[model samples]
Target: MASSNFNRWLRPEVYPLFAATGVAVGICGMQLIRNITGNPEVRVTKENRAAGILENFAEGEKYRENPVRKFVRGKSSEIMPNINNFFSKPEL
Candidate 1:
């Protein structure tokens, strides 16, 4: 009867917190692995650095424009078509 009570405490409904804690630990482990393997300064060429900065700036501009486009014109459907097309495409 004591063992049965212990098993019942381990049931999913009673132990979601444990599962969530495990997931958080796993994510931290992966991040630690990434940090260990990642390079701090490989020294990108000036041209490549400029290109990367420009690309990131463009992405930021696009992200900032998204809400303005949606609210100003209210045309969410325009975005959906492109997303649908991306998912529908077959790789060559």
Candidate 2:
């Protein structure tokens, strides 16, 4: 049963999924490293906050958001815009 399951997951069609997952993992790892090394917020320990040494960064709000999430938020949520518009139209 384990062998059959392993073979089922080893198909050529499944290669793309593995590649995509690898790429995503690599990107996330790189981003995590970049943030850990460069982001000031990452260095902010709970003890530091309690000591009241926190400085107000003007761009703090921007730093808190992911660019992809910001972009996705601006896109329309409608699956079928035409159908929705038609249904929403008032009858004369």
lDDT of each: 0.63, 0.78
| TM-score against native, each model | 0.33, 0.50
Best by TM-score: 2
Compare the candidates by lDDT and give the number of the best one.
2
- Candidate 1 per-residue C-alpha lDDT over 1-92 given as tens digits, one digit per residue, 9 for 90 to 100: 99999997888786888889999999999767644444222225666545542435554555456544768675555557777878898567
After superposition, candidate 1 runs with Cα above 4 Å error = 1-5, 39-92
Tell me the tens digit of each residue's lDDT in model 2 across 1-92.
Answer: 99999999999999999999999999999999978765656665667447654574754665666687798797788998788878998577
Which 10-residue span in candidate 2 carries the lowest summed lDDT? 51-60
